[model samples]
Target: MWLKKIGGLVAILSLSFSGMAIAETTKDNFYLQVGSNRNGDPIVLDLASVKGTEYTLLEQHGNGIERRTLRAACIQGRLFSRRLAVYESNGHLTRVDKTEQEIFPKPRSADANSMEIVCRVAANRTK
Candidate 1:
């Protein structure tokens, strides 16, 4: 009797966990929308000055315009949004010298993230 009771409890716990996972997925979907402003407003990406090696992060968010600084690292980086592709530079794992045709028109084909990095292959060649 005890073994049966314990098995039933485990089954209930498993179901609860699965339900929670679905909820988490729904939360992430909000960010995929272009003008949705899932976090109540758009995020502002920026680079900090005075103390730095030049890495821009999503620093602020609000006031309608999501701002971002075009720093050196960003010059040949890879950024993606809704179907629009942005070619910019990030430090090591990036390659920003390849032309749009060579990158996007690759032979094998790839996801957005890979396509962007492939285009910027001058810096990050292999992996």
Candidate 2:
């Protein structure tokens, strides 16, 4: 009876530890699909390469027209845009506008407009 209890405890502990490992891996590697542009081209934002509190917003436009990067911050699972400076692929700041609205993730909804850009947490496929 004592041996059975010990085995059950071990199994429980192992499962908890595995869950923690999975959470840690996903905590910093979240991605957001930023939707498509006015031209019907898709855009994806990758936050998986974030380091510490700072993160690089990699904007990959579907067409070969525009590709930019913006410096941002992530706080408690909510990403905040810090500036309006859009940088080129070569690290050159091209446009700076203080009126640019900050971006954040929103819940996926069925009534979302097709032209409007909506962001949501990327689904984890490892499950």
Model 2 misplaced stretches (Cα beyond 4 Å): 1-34, 60-77, 87-92, 97-104, 109-127
For residues 12-95, what per-residue lDDT tens digits would candidate 1 score against the true structure?
Answer: 111122122111112111111111124543222111210122222221123212222222222444332221122222212222
* Total clashes for model 2: 0
lDDT of 2 at 29: 43
lDDT score, residue 91, model 2?
Answer: 51
Q: Which candidate wins on lDDT?
A: 2
Q: Residue 12 in model 1: shift from native, Å?
A: 52
Instruction: Report lDDT (Cα) of residue 41, candidate 2.
Output: 36
Per-prediction tally of clashes = 7, 0
| Model 2 pairs whose backbones collide | none
Worst 10 residues of 1 by lDDT: 22-31
